[model samples]
Target: MKNARYLPLLLCLCWGGQAFADTPLDLSHPAAPTVHVEINNVKGKVTIIAWDRNEVHVGGLLGDGAAPLSIEGSENNLSIKVQAQGHNGWFNWSGDKAMSDTELNINVPRAASLKVNVVSAPLSVDGIDGGDIAVNSVSGRVRIDARTPMLEAVTVSGNVAFSGHAKQAKLQTVSGDILAPSLGQNADLQTVSGHIQASGGPWAQLNLSTVSGDVQLTGELAPSGTMSIDSMSGDVQLQFPASLSSSVHASTFSGDLRSDFGTPKQPEHGPGSTLDTVAGNGNGKISVETFSGDLRIRKQD
Candidate 1:
């Protein structure tokens, strides 16, 4: 009787092992030069590559038990999403009984605008050079190498790394670090307890903020550019070329301040310090404030 009862268990184990079927994916559709594309996946890696062709091609494996990809719209705008079987809405599951991991490798026109959302799937995007690119995730690391017009990427507890050019970019995280090797004309980066590191040239506007994390910036400011930085208890470091022309004003409540431009002033009977100096002709503006974190300003060789 015990052996008979164990047969059911053995069958279940066999079924579980073969439950996830790797369904092949091959779909193509005509696309406009600047078509808007959106893709959503809950728990699998998504890779988007830019192609010279004027059509969007999707080829990958769809996990069994998952619904067919919901592809909608026309050549100008399109939406692609993966959902669970018999489920009509999106669900972010992260435990036993979660959906099988589906992989999506999509190729779109180089100039198509793109957007992707996922719960815990890492996203990689490359070569997009038109419109805007936006990505959102719950806990998935995002990396982009695109020369788009605008970029907006946000995640919760996932790191973000960008290495490309954009007219305007906004990157944020709630406990994840941000690395931008080449910032755009205007960039805004924020995090909570996550470090921020960026480098670029002649930024017209730059905004950085963090709580309990460090901020490191090495770039150039435009002649009329403006920068604002705020932190509760994080260190801030700014590195600029020797030929920088900016008016800097930085203050801290109970932290040390060091600068290569000018000396920091301390009140006679206060627990705060300030740095009010001008670099070169002071054509730009910079403002920094912190609660209890150190500040360092240096010249970049």
Candidate 2:
């Protein structure tokens, strides 16, 4: 009878051992509606969602040998970092083969300001409203679905996709495509060897710069909006509504230029062409400059 009683204890110990192998995390902190949250991670997926509650919740699975998620700072300003265990310094796991990766799922207030930094890990943010958001990544795709006043995203060799509205946005990438279907008032997009495809807004000001990458923009312009595209050896295409009023000035050096509003004029002595004309009432301004790239300006049906 004594041996039978010990059997239950042995089973309990075995079950506890198995549970200890996988590290689970569930943490929360009280936060204000406009709280500032910063998350720094390396080499793992991070997903953030905005909720109506005024608190920050972080829950995820840590890989084997990974350190627990660290949350610090006050309620107004908080920072979350994931460090690899058995590392030489805090949050530094360079040259450590036994380091573990982390997959984080976080929830913050809907109006909180967020800044996320990652290296080679995909980052996703959704359902944010009325706060500044910035995401910086290297070689990891970034997807955002938010409506904020200001938004900025930068990536190196990773695609960026946004489906929302913002008052002002700045996006930069290298060798990765940028796709934004719904952008807002003012946008500045820059890329090197990466294509930019965007459609949105009656923008007040839009600036696009690229080197050896195509740029395609289709949207409405504010009454006095200004849109400019500068490219080097990449195609540029802009499509506007048929009733749009814009002044266009396009020039190309050794490139083909096609416009629906005006006729192209080539210099008689130089190997270049320029088009300077006004469409509709010419209330807006559109300028495109390219070198050895095809430029097309179309009127939307």
lDDT of each: 0.89, 0.88
What are the C-alpha RMSDs, in order, of all predicted structures?
Answer: 2.5, 4.9
Estimated TM-score per prediction?
A: 0.92, 0.89
Q: Best candidate per lDDT, number?
A: 1
Q: What's each prediction's clash count?
A: 0, 0
lDDT by residue (63-120, candidate 1, tens digit) is 7767877467999999888888877676735321357888999999999999898878
Candidate 2 clashing pairs, residues 3+ apart or interchain = none
